[model samples]
Target: MAHIGPAYGSLAANQAKISAKRDPALDQEVQTWIETIIGEKFPNGSYEDALKDGVILCKLMNKLQPNSIPKYATSGGSFKLRENIALFQTAARAYGLEDAELFQSVDLFEKRNIPQVTQCLFALGRHAQRHHFNGPILGPKMSEANMREFTEEQLNAAKNALPLLNEGMNKGANQSGQNFGLTRHI
Candidate 1:
């Protein structure tokens, strides 16, 4: 019988490539925090564990883009919620994500697509940083001038960060036997 070496070599290879482009220390630190959060929050956790824990998800989002969750939370009142909906819709359109894909409903936590949601939020946060968007939602109407201001390094960093974000989500989901999906929604 042929020995199959590492059934998931592709995942390992992708992780290694991403690690090469980023600071290993930072990666380790973030991974460690994610693991700790999972251990504390979901000892026998499932994908739903991470999804349902808004605090944990917000913490991760804050690390990706400071104050993002708080900004979203502070936008109180029905009118503000509607405004945020429009803002996110515009931003999602700019990011080429479907309007339905917006992380609007808490019921989204019930979906099996937490990894996709995590990636979307991560991308939106990166876009917000590049555009100096300070809205409650990570999405803000983008202009060509704003897009032009993003450096190649910044763009590449965002691209590279996706896998890391996915890996963190995978770590949490692992307790529940759910692997992060690789489908690129953005």
Candidate 2:
């Protein structure tokens, strides 16, 4: 039998390149959290959509399911849903959703009157039990135990829950692509 050394070397090189292109596990973890929060709270929305919204579901959702995205707060002092919605739309565009109709669904709330949107986010948070996000993006010191209280469980919960959330997002995105011909443009 002929030795296929060059062919095997090329295959190995290709595999290495593919592995290098894979998304960082940590980023995937965060993405998972975003998806989980979106699903339980904003069932109709996407992970890309919820992440861009910036509702911070981890702290907001603590009583719901592991995969719930808490609904946004509705009290007078709570964050404005319209602004967050716009932010989320912007983020979604950045995350491979450029020119997608994903933002169209949120336009109605852009005119203000976002109580429903807020409520939906809060509910998602509640279901997901997200309590705190302490990462480089939000700044490491933001979650300092001295300035604030944080149980190891909460931190670990977020960490462990991430992969599952990402799985959900993958499934959701796959379904969307199957149902609506959506493609990853970015």
Candidate 3:
């Protein structure tokens, strides 16, 4: 008879593997961290208010990463530069947004506006849920070689921050004022 390895695909085996790795207490701690961060950032519980701070936050991000945004070349003498600026002005006028708002949004997109801790946590939670994890996975995997795992303390902090994240996400959804059917689903 030939010897065979244990069946890694069996339910019992999988359960044992998961049990060895999963730490429910640590999971709860991480959730607590997430909630705490959110509460501290938004004592009054308003994500819209946080978004209103984005312009200043984006400016700070720009300072940290200079020239990360595409500029209209205001001082350039080239015809193409003038054309681009005129086009940008026309688009801004059409959208009823100031040029600064447009630039700020671009900066926010590039930098992810991480200074808004609640929003950042919400995004991380969403991403983790999408990937079927209680929290973001940080470590090397055979499938995802570059995946990074958070330290135990970091995970606990994120857990404590979850409530604020949930509040911010919910507030943002409601503030959008567009019926995306989230109310019915949630």
TM-score of 1: 0.29
Q: What lDDT would candidate 3 get against the real structure?
A: 0.39
Write candidate 2's Cα lDDT for 107-168 as tens digits: 23321223323333333333223233331121121222357778999888877765755666
Q: Candidate 1 lDDT, tens digit per residue, 88-140?
A: 44545554556555665333333324444454554554455565644333334
| Candidate with more favorable, higher TM-score: 1 or 3 | 1
The reply for model 3, stretches above 4 Å from the true place, is 1-9, 40-186
Q: Give the winner by lDDT: 2 or 3.
A: 2
Q: Considering lDDT, which of the candidate structures 1 and 2 is the better prediction for this target?
A: 1
User: Which candidate should be chosen as best, given lDDT against the real structure?
Assistant: 1
Writing each residue's lDDT as its tens digit, candidate 3 over 49-92 gives 33333332232222323342344433344443434434433443
Give each model a TM-score. 0.29, 0.22, 0.18
As a TM-score, model 3 comes out at 0.18
Q: Candidate 2 lDDT (Cα, whole model)?
A: 0.40
**Which of the numbered candidates is closest to the native, going by highest TM-score?**
1
Best-to-worst ranking by TM-score: 1, 2, 3
lDDT of 2 at 169: 54
- Candidate 1 scores a C-alpha RMSD against the true structure in Å of 22.6
